[model samples]
Target: MTGKLGIGIITYNRKDILQTTISSIFRHTKTPFEFVVADDGSSDGTPDLLKQLNVPHVTGRNKGISWNRNRVLWYLKEEKGCDWILILEDDCFPSTFGWELPWIEALERYGHVNYMPEITIEIDNDITSGSGTAEDPFIAPMHQAFCVGYHAKALSYVGYLDVRFEKYGEEHVEHTQRFLRAGYGGLSQYLSPERGQLFYLRGGLDTLPSHSHGNPEIAQRNQAIHNSIRHEPLYRHPWRTDEQMFEFREEIATALTRPPVEPPSDPQLFNSIISLGGDGIVNRAIKDNFHWAGLGLFDQFLVPFHTLTAFLQHNFAGLLSTTCLYGYHDALRCRDTLTIYHNCLDKPAHVHASVEMFHEQLPALQYRFRSMIQEMDELCHKTQRVLFIRSWRDGLYYKGQHRPDHSATPDFRALTDAIAARYPELDFRIMFVNFGNAYVDDPRMIFANTRTPDDSTAEEELAGWKDLFSKHRITLLQNR
Candidate 1:
């Protein structure tokens, strides 16, 4: 008993590409549904084209992707009183013949359906299509609202997509999680073609929004939003008891069981202890973070930070910090803001903001601790993990004329002890890896303080890690 159906195609200045998309729907679509177009302030004669085509369209004041999509949903559900609606991006297209009815029938069968085109196969470049069975289609744990169909009844609980995602990205995954938390996630099946089959235009992401050419602040904002939604499940009704959180986690885990996100591994991957380096490295770099997530699991258990400034300040007695914009510099000089793994992402505005925010922390200020601490807090908030690894020689310090004594165990021990005093609650394991000669035969030598004289013996080096992790209730596992 499907009521009046509404099909919306959202566009934002991609008029050239969108023309083919609209034509394809008319060519292949057999379902009796109203075609509604929502334009997000397109300037390339898109509105005029829609008018000439006699398509019922609405104009927006350059809102954004989420706002434009929601506008279409609002009209279909609220204004037109449609029972079901399908929203397609201006770039998406049908690859196979008569692919529309199956998706429409899916809405009739279940309350909602997320149409997963065969793009994943091409993306992965896999051996086979791996186009899963109907009963066991690839159950996506994360949602990308590329193209989707929704039953109107599910809307009563799921509400509308969050408008906070003003630009591209983050909106799809968040909305999908919303449906899951609200219990409508189960009423959906994914539709995907066989491997090597693409149900889309030749070039999708390459055309719009300067794909990946974005400000670093956007990355930070996106990550922050993701953390909030993941940490706080805004279920229509909260879970009865704290115990129910486990049920939720288990349910989500079960939903994610198909198409394993992690590569094929041991069935008991979670139970096993994992480590990537020598005992000394693991000892100095592991931490058992007790912060709990919304789902009640340990927030972050192990994290490591091996950097030039961290090692000099925490392992050696050397003070480390960037030469202030208006401050004096002695023998050793370093960029106060040591940004790693970032290039054009850090816009000038954000970099300047951070520059102004830098302030004095310790009295002598051997190294900048505030920014690093903020970074650690963010990492802990995200992974429930923190860094304990300190490289004896990092890039900036290594480039200098002088190098610190690599075998200064007493100095290392004292600094590590002071760090422990500062963070008494961190169930800490630490290591200092010497990267003085990174490219030579010994790329990174593992450094251990003299708790035991024999550094060569595996038994002596890894003496207390078992007990330390045991106390913290962590089963350390090694992956790489």
Candidate 2:
């Protein structure tokens, strides 16, 4: 196997730090390696500096750390024709204590090994370095900064750094795990104490200021990258347990599986703006309609309509229609008091007409309110429904008036109790988003109102409602 090494360094806007890193690499390492700098759309003068150095480099079209690293690897394989690649970040400065020699030795000895050096991170007076070695129990490091040998055969086996994991978290771990699962062994080497001294001056990777401090933009970029990776179909790992991670992965998978929409550069942020703006438009529309209906300006006729319309347009108008349906059901419950009031005033002889009238009108609502309630019951089932689902599903639907009081009526307790009794097998979790003094006197009023005189009192009332809606399984979320 050819042992030729290609030095691949990835950088963003840290031109000065990158310069020092390049200098250290050229100074301490006597090995004849072709240097490849992968520039990730740096606005700084780093590209100009690279041009002056006349080193073989590749500039990426977009800004992404993982993408830059992968670009370097592709460039080395395609253009440099190097069998092995020494990958390093822009800030890692190789030390003098046989830093270059040890990497070569480790790779030579361990043939086909992914060698990681003991990195000494310096922060003011504190220094952190690796402890274990190849002979001992190995704890994996996050960054692949040392040496990685690429065989022509293994080249086909390995995939790119998940471009979605653009920022700094679990990308390396995922990559290492993938290679390890494929039967590759990792190697580690200790740096000489003298060489470790130079590592202290290397200011980039130190935990003193933290990565977020050094580059806040990188942190934001990382979120998008990680989101993108999670969205990839092939990136799913079954062993992951975190709910947030799983949610992210599911969201990403959904995004990848669905056809691409020409989203604005920042889709999450853009979506947030659209949600807020859409809520405003829906609210204005509802308010205007209520004003024309002879309802006083302060009258709450538009509240429920606005809430339902905003939710439907914001979340379900496109891909999230099912989730939007859940919000419409919630909006109906919140405005039940208004519906009751309207029915009482409109038909004085028939006080019981409100529920039936609302049910009749539910079909004409923008979100298919009645049908959505059934769909949510089916999709979430009894086991998966929780109080958080109400907020999560509702919040996603509408970015307007987060006032829980506005959306939840005084009669919510009755409705919740009814739902709980009907679905004995399902666990419903509910959290009250106290909208503060905006709607009710106490912000905690929503929670207070939901509580019955005692657990048994609540249970008995719920049982009665359960008998009424026996055919439908409905879980009521309790406010904690």
Alpha-carbon RMSD, each predicted model:
24.2, 20.8
- Residues 359-418, candidate 2: write the lDDT tens digits: 455445434434544544453353343332111112313322223222344333433444
Please report, in order, the local distance difference test score of every candidate based on alpha carbons: 0.46, 0.41
Query: Which stretches in model 2 have alpha-carbon errors above 4 Å?
Result: 108-154, 186-480
Backbone clash pairs for candidate 2 read 164-225, 164-226, 164-229, 165-225, 231-252, 231-253, 386-429, 387-429, 387-430
User: How does candidate 2 score on lDDT?
Assistant: 0.41
- Candidate 2, which ten residues in sequence have the lowest lDDT sum? 267-276
RMSD of 1: 24.2
The alpha-carbon deviation from the true structure for residue 443 of candidate 1, after best TM-score superposition, in angstroms, is: 88
TM-score of each: 0.42, 0.37
